[model samples]
Target chain A: MIHIRRDVCGYCGACVSVCPRGALELIDAYLTVDETLCKSKCKICSTVCPLGAIELEEQ
Target chain B: MKEAYDVLVVGGGPGGALAAKAAAEQGLSVLLVEKRPAIGAPVRCAEGIGKEALAEFIEPDPKWIAADLDKAVLIGPDGTKFTIGNNHSGGKVGYVLDRKVFDRELVWQAAEAGAEIQVHARASAPIMIDGKVSGAVIHQHGKTYEVRAKVVIAADGVESKFAKWAGINTTVPLTELETCAQYIVNDIDIDERANLFYISYTDAPWGYIWVFPKGHRCANVGIGIAGTKSGEGHRAKDYLDRFVAREFPNGKITELIVGGVSVCKPLECTVADNLIIVGDAARLSDPITGGGIYNAMYTGKLAGEVAAAALKKGDTSKMALMVYDTTWREGPLGHALARNYAVKESFIKMDDAKFNSIIHSMSDLSLDEITVKSLVIAIFKANPWLALELPRLLMTL
Candidate 1:
């Protein structure tokens, strides 16, 4: 699962744009990730987040 | 129960607020809606604006200003620094704004002028009747409501969909869109003034790195790259991260802002029967600087005034609203944006050596002699080969 730190996310929607799978959406000024659509082993969101808000968990 | 408004302004940024204020001041019932929980939260801008441009809207209040900039330093690709004093009238002098305070204040001003404001209201789509926009469907707190208005001012930002829903073409080519990433960093060593560093075709291809100072040793450091150069292996964040690590190694980033800016010419049509688009949705941002705050508010005021006039005449037809487009394009703002777009196109094609030479030539000229005409002359004088493209460039202005 990918973890999103709501406390730090600025909700600028950068991750949503860069997500190749269209798995992220900004809902009510918060970044909401759709796990089913998120590509496994994809680090693009975590890498591109300016606040480092998105983190990947170890299986 | 639902009520109809004279004008419904969407997206409560500077443009939306100003439009609402202008309409309400004319005694027209106006409503301004913002999707955010609070206005100006989750800032997506570099927050810099020219003093003169801002003066045309409202007097500067200390409550919204972060730093008053007196100079702008430009760094060439070869690491040569050229400093320009902000002494020129109607240009150069600027301020880094606290957008949270600034945006909220604009909305407050609109409310004070008698415009109703609603936060957490998201405009889902336009309500069209017989191919004409009559109002919009808004979603708030998991409930949907249809709001009717005689005129709808689309002040939505870059990712705007209202214009498209209204049957207006708002497609932007990838080449004209800028992918941007920024960080609000603290404990950084920077001059009190702002600086724009350009390293053409490298590090930030077709874009530049900006460091806008905020007081208390804090600054907004950011990078923007041409959209065409940003995918498949190149990322704007990678470039921004590298620059931040090298320049502000000891700095702590407090916030991250990511967004896109359209740097194309204004859309062919910004108005269509009872609907007008202002601000970024209208693609009013400067092509070279990616600055839209000043233009957004300027055009927003015009749209509001025009919409009011159309209402007074009891005509909200597309023909009546065409005046807004004409006034904006023929005004100083339009001329400036068009000219800057030309400069941006030409500047993006130059190699590092060409950029260095141009900067070298500019370094010798006094700021007073650095007008657009003179700058063109300087470029031609530095590298005569560019003279062939002068006519095409001049025509854009």
Candidate 2:
């Protein structure tokens, strides 16, 4: 449902740290997601994101 | 004859209520006007607040609270990380308040102190005499009337147009204003004890994203950007969306509020003759956090006290009204506000790598140093750019 660009992510890790679903992580200097772990319960990280790099698709 | 009030507070927000409370307790007659039909309806905040700053004015009540928070996230422009750790600036540690109830409680408290309140009344301008501020003009239900008072307190909020009428300069430079927007969402699972602030350099450049959880299932998610940083093209809503689409592809925006936060220094003077400005009207908001509830109440209390004193002395002039502005700036909130503005400036300049390093690193530091300055300093240690920005902020602090 959510997409993060590895190239432009800049690896700030803010999204990784703040995700309530425990969905995001930092791997190789970019943001990664634990797709299996995410409940799609809520996505607070994308809303409060700083760089505007996030994109979402409907389930 | 119904006599004029001793203290007339324009606005029934936290500032107005507190102003009325402080004045009435001091034995001054007070009147509070609210433009809305209700005291605390249509809540607009992410609903988060530090607890200690709140104690400066009133005691904590669970009747107005939803949750406690103990963490912050600092992301960079490009998704880099910075972690500020956990800190308590306001008392009792944290909260995600039920603002509608919370605000009404404040008004009730003021009323208990003998302050009168009127809803749906919009204050227009100050009632002046011989070049000195006295009271204000109000319009309600298609009827206009002039209310006279010894002291008038303007708690009209940020972007308020009252100061011009009172003959005071209240312009907030574009650079000093932060355009903010938010969404209340359902089904967000978060630690009830920890709140989240997500920052990224390329993500928000001048603003950060916030997800203040109401409980294990609900959250108020939002982002805010410094005005003039990205120019007309920069929109808080757009940033919020882009971030959400990436992080919360499934979450939908349930409620939205577009507003602004001011990071500029407090107005040079908040008092003009018999008139005193509190809250956003006087720019008492937190620059780094963009939080104003606690600070607004703090300033409102001070404003009310000063208004009461002026009435008692029959000297509602500039000399008698200086009390409100001087007191708060010297208190704990004011001390933090100054440090926060400096942090706000440094924060806007960071990129993702620095933010990432700092935020990820925060997981290792003690949660106590999460003050705005401490977080910036930690990130500065990791990034030379931040280190370079520190000097200017440090000098000001």
lDDT of all the models against the reference? Answer: 0.81, 0.70
**Proportion of native contacts kept per candidate:** 0.18, 0.00
**Candidate 2 chain A, which ten residues in sequence have the lowest lDDT sum?**
A9-18
Residue B370, model 2: Cα distance from true site in angstroms: 3.7
lDDT of 1 by residue, B1-397 (tens): 1568999998899999999999999999998888889999878899988887789998998899998877677788887776656554333478899999999999999999999999998887888988888889988888899999999999977756677768777755666777788999999778876545555578788888889998778999998887667653466777889888988999999987887787889999899999999998898999888999998999899999999999999999999999999999988888888788888878787788877877777676545332344555555666666767666785564
Q: What's model 1's lDDT at B66?
A: 92
**Candidate 2 residues B33-132, lDDT tens each?**
8876778765556778766656666677878877766665544444544434345533245778888888999999999999888888777667779987
The CA-based lDDT of model 1 is what?
A: 0.81
Question: How much does candidate 1 score in TM-score?
Answer: 0.87
Docking class of 1: incorrect
Best prediction by TM-score: 1
TM-score of chain B of 2: 0.90
**Model 1 off-target regions past 4 Å?**
A1-27, A30-59, B86-92, B368-383, B395-397
